[model samples]
Target: MPTVAQIEQALFQLAPKDLAFDWDNVGHLEGSPDQEVQRVLVALDVTENVVSEAEKLGCQLIVSHHPLMNVRWHQAEMQTLRPDRYLGRLLRRLVKADISVISMHTNLDIAPGGVNDALAEALRIEDPGPMPGDETGLCRVGRLRNPVKLSDFAGEVCKALHANGVRYAGDRPVEYIAVGGGACGDEIDAVIAAGCDTFVTSDLTYHQFLDAAPKGINLIDAGHFPTEDPVCAKIVAYLEKEFPQLIIIKSTSHKEVIQYFVEGE
Candidate 1:
């Protein structure tokens, strides 16, 4: 049986801790490093439901993309675990259950076969490679098989990510495309510089859309969850291959936080 530290070492090979952002927490977030692990659960976020799912499935470790410990301070250490609050209650439950956790954020996004790569694959981008001027490899630039209308391209994005809806700017033809999973709208300029006429990412602001419209770069806000969730299954596959003896499961309780409901007929 593998230990938490041993699995962590394998994870590090895929998404190294040194590649993580300076402030971003990536690595063991909780539990004993030497604790033995028989099963592991992978999820996009470590929410209360994900924790419960792990416990129900008898998973000894929970590997997630977003860091549940990315707080300004160690709120989990606070004396009281308020039942009324989600964070406090979640922390208390994890401690009581003695479950281990690992979060790979920015490091996973930049790693090869990571978040951005998964997005590019889903979109059918050709010759996908790192975005120009993006030293961290956080953004990927590629070309479509043929040019398509902005609206049609957006629909393709929605289908690929299983998104409820997609918001975009610009109505021209799209060929070259760029993708940055999660909130990475800041790379719009780099996308343009890379000769990409369209950008696919999440958390695009009103001002960002306005700014990109004039530059002829169509921008699509595909929602953070859909943009990154594909990587969760990828993680499960990797872990399954790396540790065949251990049981690897993806959380059934996790789903998109945002939904698009049509108006009443």
Candidate 2:
């Protein structure tokens, strides 16, 4: 069995720590590094349910896209653990279960074959590359195999990402495309600068859609969880290959929490 530190090392290679934004947290955030791990669970977020699932599965470690603890929580002043709070409750559960946590946040988003790339592949974007003029490289620019109407492409995105529904703007045909998994709606300017006629991402504000429509760019807000969840499978596959002797599973109990409703349904 591999130690938690060993698995963390492998993950660091997959998404180097330096690639992570300075303000973002990544790598091993909880539990003993030297703890041996025979089974691991992967999930997009380390929620209460995910922690419970890890306990039930006998997983020694959980590898997640989002950090279990926020950057502010790492402060010495915030170190007082209170079980009443959400993060505090989850932390207590994890500590009791002896489940370690490793987060691959913005680094995973910027890494090759990571979140953005996985999303592009899901949408069938051809020849995906780093978004131009975006130093963070949190987004990917590419072209679809063929041009399609914005409405048609939105449908494809919803289906591809398993989104309950998608909110979109613009009526132009989509060909060149850009993708940013999670709350990357702010990158619309970079998407336009990259010459992408369509931008597929999540967590957009109404103002963003309003601003984008007149700019002749198609924007699809596919929901944050849907956009980033594809990378969980990628993580599972990578870890399985790296540690063939260990059991690595994507969390079956964790999933998109949001649902959509239509009138008279």
Worst 10 contiguous positions by lDDT, candidate 2:
71-80
State residue 26's C-alpha deviation in candidate 1, in Å: 0.7
- Which portions of model 2 show Cα errors greater than 4 Å? 72-79
Best by the lDDT measure: 2
Task: Compose the digit string of candidate 1's lDDT tens values, residues 1-265.
Answer: 9999999899999988888888888899889999899999999999989999999998899999998787544555455568777777887788789899988899999999999999999899999998888876799988998999999999999998999888999866999899999999888888888888899999989999988778878999999999999899899999999999999998889988787776782
Score residue 144 of candidate 2 by CA lDDT: 77
Clash pairs of candidate 1? none
Looking at model 1, report the run of 10 residues with the lowest lDDT sum.
71-80
